[model samples]
Target: MAGSLRYRLQPIRKTKMYRYDQYDHLIVKERVAQYRDQVRRRLADELTEEEFLPLRLQNGLYMQRHAYMLRIAVPYGMLSSPQVRMFAHIARKYDRGYGHLTTRQNIQFNWINLEQSPDILAELATVEMHAIQTSGNCIRNTTSDELAGVAADEIIDPRPYAEMIREWSTFHPEFAFLPRKFKIAISGAEQDRAATAVHDIGLHVVKNAEGEVGFRVLVGGGMGRTPIIGSVIREFLPWQHALTYLEAILRVYNQHGRRDNKYKARIKILVKALSAEEFARQVEAEWLDIKDGPATLTAEELQRIAQYFTPPPYETLPATDAGFEGQKTDNKGFANWLKRNVKAHKVSGYAAVILSVKKTGVPPGDITAAQLDFVADLADQYSFGEVRVTHEQNLVLADVKISELFTVWQAVKAQGLATPNIGLLTDIICCPGGDFCSLANAKSIPIAQAIAEKFDNLDFQHDIGDIELNISGCINACGHHHVGNIGILGVDKDGSEWYQVSIGGAQGNNTSIGKIIGPSFSAQQMPVVIERLLNVYVQQRTEEELFIDTVQRLGIAPFKEFVYASPIPTGYTHGEDACVY
Candidate 1:
């Protein structure tokens, strides 16, 4: 261990850790042992790569171009300070000192050795966390609104339902060997922060007219080769019948979902082929048998689960703190941070603060281990020792006091997390494109970086206000490009990276897929095209108009003309002269 050579040859160390309960510890220990055995068998050539693929993927291990990548699930995007510290520790110890927060609300550490994966999983389990079901055909992490428990608009905290789904789906016997991976998201608030509409199954917890709590279920929304908005299968499914109804939906899909063609295998395709009405009828028919059966949730069981997610005792504090007002009046930066990052919390004194990971010239959602530790400390100090990961790939301090806003802003700014660009043009949602993903047709991170760099001015971003610029590596739409106000899809044109642009997409209540404006642009021309598109909106829009609203009114024609009329030379043509910059 004295010399560098000796250090390099040192055996990897496994550390024992603590958890809240015996079941948590026991499960993690068993899982580690199981995975270690799996790894040993694979290395010994007993398990073929094909056989080992699903096993590894289930444990959140991916064999990438250079090495293994491990995705750690942040269940419902909720994390304690200690859990986050453990994440930082793992990132620093096992892999590079950085982690990527994925759109699915998980953190992925690249450069993990195959040998070290079991140890990592062991470490994660100590914090009541694991990589299980992070990937593969079984239900993935049951995501919910990031501000689930704390949001003022919330009818009910969706975390309890999410956790129920998580447990039920963990080792679901029948649905485990499905045709493709399934994703489900739940939201309880009026504002659909969970992007439930775009998920395989979107559950919206609501109170029906009869004063009964139930879910308005939407099924078949996905963003792979064919992106489709989920269709509403049930306008109102009784709370007690949640599981039985879901089982019915899954059973129908498993039986009839396409298995012949991988591209056409998603539930979305099935829904389309059968039509939403027919699919709904089939699911209803299947549910009739299972309704009021063992799968039906009892009030006691629901209450028992709800107990775990009960809100922490929050003291009544003043709505406006003098200190916060003074700081905002004194410091312009603090005021800007308050304006952009802080969201209203249900409690009087508390505010939800969005930590923008979208810094200029950096890949969005990429945070260093040191930064993770810094955020964990901030969460402990200012917030209530909790952090939430947003679907848009941002971190949120869900319970910061108004009195501590300035202090929180200072700490965040020091760590480069206070970009004051949340929901702005610079805050791009992008995927790990050609750099890491084998499926990508073109590079997405670079395009995101380029846009961020191009629109560095905070004032300019503010003027361009609330624009969602989403980029995908391919048509698979991992970055949710289809729902962005301005969408960019990467395409391969004779081997070069070309980007197709779309406009008028929105993911909120008025959700719609973006319409393609015209022919694709070279990577170099994308920024210019986006700029021109924005310029057209700025020139033509009425006061306080958003990007989508402008596009909806003018249609894609104006934007298309502006984009293609002066196409950049060396970029694809729409049969028009290149516009002079």
Candidate 2:
């Protein structure tokens, strides 16, 4: 690895292997051979860049600012220990010694040679994973809650349905060349960890009056230049009709979705233009033809898919592990971890632990190669040889025994993975920004770094309470700025970097878009503006009121008054006064 900051920012490209069955192995092996030939032909000028672009993108290859970047699918954020180890292995062997986890729960290798991509695809195919449908204007990786099966409030496991959609949409002939990319998210829990409300098509598992399992489907919800929470189209859609209904929605979008304007190509725009009711009627009309068609999920196939995600044979344990108390009494750091990272598991003695990536001053959601290996080892040691990547870009050790949590925490902490700020203000969600992305308007990473540095005091952060601060380099909203309780968007004002702020947005069960507080602030003024906003919240908030709640009750007026009061210069200095932004 190079020591230069530019080199450190460079992406890695590695060969990945998948865990495949006989049929899948054969198909992927053949596809690799085919792709290898395609690569050769393209290199030989048999195919033009324009013609080869889509072909390569469909295989997860992108010609980025620096090099060809490959995005590998981690379907529904699920990964076995073996899969995780393979990812670590690829990271170590490739261009760099690390990989980046995306907002979509996929892993991206930022540097690769075009000639080596087929070899990489071949390696991934061996592990039952691939970059297929990771790019291009088609249904991408179907995401779900990381806590799908184990959450106490879950109605059903969503992975089987996610897998079903993955299979149906992979290389679907009609949707391959749609106007724009499509994303679908499913959630089984009452909590919206999957961000279902912000997807192109969102499905929430539900049971109707008859106690029959089905889907409460919503359409046209997405975050970007136009952010809208999905509107419910069907109160109850039978479970078996998942594929058929989704196909109908996609077909309509593929035909009528905007192709003339790239900015408005998303299906969310179409849904907005027609209204949710009109979109529903259009889908209903289309579904009439495919209701009983081949795309309808079959019971036997669903059963087979469900088997892969069946709960591990967990041993019964006592409600409270006696060993845990002694461990907590001995270690303060471990105790703090238990307080912040652990979540309630459905099983009594088992715990789901969130391995926070939001360590102060580091880029949020970043894990090094060594850290990845350590997590793999911890998963194998404590969990059921499995790990899950969260929508928030953290790792989850889902089946750790309460008795072993102390040991797990110690190991995680040693590897710099035990940041005790899961949903705190410092746990910012940010995109690659101007540092790596070609589409960025300004650098988001530096802004996040500045914010984290200014708020490094844990007590101050806790006092400010839970705030979802999201930053996006551009209007695409990959960092989910629209739904952040405090959103920051990077915009190019002339040639300088300016950030627009929004407040009161949320993405849980009660989803709402953030409202702009006032005018944009220059990068140098951002940290001060944020401080003023927090000061306003702290002063106006009643007992136990969160930043969001305070804003909701009193509105953004008080915060606005302080933020716009002084009209600071572009490179303004606020003395040594931390409170006066």
Total backbone collisions for each predicted model: 1, 12
Cα-based TM-score, every candidate: 0.94, 0.93
Superposition TM-score, candidate 2 onto the true structure: 0.93
Give the residue spans of candidate 2 off by over 4 A: 1-19, 567-577
**Model 1: per-residue Cα lDDT over 379-415, one tens digit each:** 7777767888988999999888888888888888988
* Deviation in Å, model 1, residue 392 alpha carbon: 0.6
lDDT of 2 by residue, 338-431 (tens): 7778999998898899998888777877677888888888887899788888877788888888888888887888888887777888888988
Looking at model 2, which ten-residue stretch has the lowest summed lDDT? Answer: 1-10
TM-score (C-alpha) between model 1 and the true structure: 0.94
